[model samples]
Target: MRVSAKSDYALRALIEMTNRTAERAVSAEELGRAQEVPSGFLQAILADLRRAGIVRSQRGQSGGWRLATEPTAVSVADVIRAVDGPLVSVYDMRPESVRYQASAEVLQHVWIAARVALREVFEEVTLAQLASGDLPDAVTARTAHEDAWQSH
Candidate 1:
């Protein structure tokens, strides 16, 4: 369930774009500078986001990048998936696609539950929420638990 640096950078770029005037395009350099991400890496992330239909790029002097859709319509899961694929996987395969022997039957349920729990948080959270600093109560409550903040 670890998030990659690419996903983190993409989300940061999106948040930067979200803060801009709706019609304004943000250059990769601006986004990278604002988020402290490498400009070259940010470009690659932007390309991935564009391919995922989460962002659009413009050319010419006024050209830059903007979200393809409203921030509210783009979930954290979407951003992560755009760059990193599935949120959870067993040996790189989706939980449902894996076959388990009788002795390992319980492991399947464990994997499925893990994926579901991860989705419950990520799918419910949108880029707008992150940009606005308005997280859902469910997310806040879950993270508020003492154990949630402590290292395992």
Candidate 2:
């Protein structure tokens, strides 16, 4: 599954916020500058995140955006989904929505397995872990594999 730039920027913004004073709200412009995201695009992303209940916005001199929940409670998948929808899809539809003929029946299981594996990683990883640069043992092990870094 490929994450969109919007999702990536949203995640980066969240990570930046994690490193700041949680009690203080951060303006989109400030976040964009710190994260290197375009200010205009970051505003839209912040709105989407607000709509998803992942963030809360204030509207005055001291107004800005802040996480609605603790960083540890927000998964990477949550941020990605808020901005980009599902974690995995085939032809823009979920794996469960896709049907396969007898000749391709086994392929469905493969797709499902792939989706499950991805969820196993994304679902278990929270923004706190990422912002802290402390990954889980399973995630570290998977990335440590020689094949994990291969171009193809």
Give the top-scoring candidate (lDDT).
1
Q: Candidate 2: lDDT over CA atoms?
A: 0.89
Instruction: State in Å the error of residue 123, model 1.
Output: 0.7
Which has the greatest TM-score?
A: 1
Q: List the residue pairs that clash in candidate 1.
A: none
lDDT (10s digit) by residue, model 1, range 1-152: 68899999998889888878486888999999999999999999999999999999999999999899989999999999999999988889998899989999899899999989988999999989999989999999998878988987
Give Cα distance to truth, residue 106, candidate 2, Å.
2.3
Show pairs that collide, candidate 2: none
Total clashing residue pairs per candidate? Answer: 0, 0
Scored by CA lDDT, what does every candidate get?
0.91, 0.89
Per-residue CA lDDT of model 2 for 49-73, tens digit only, reads 9999999998899999998988899
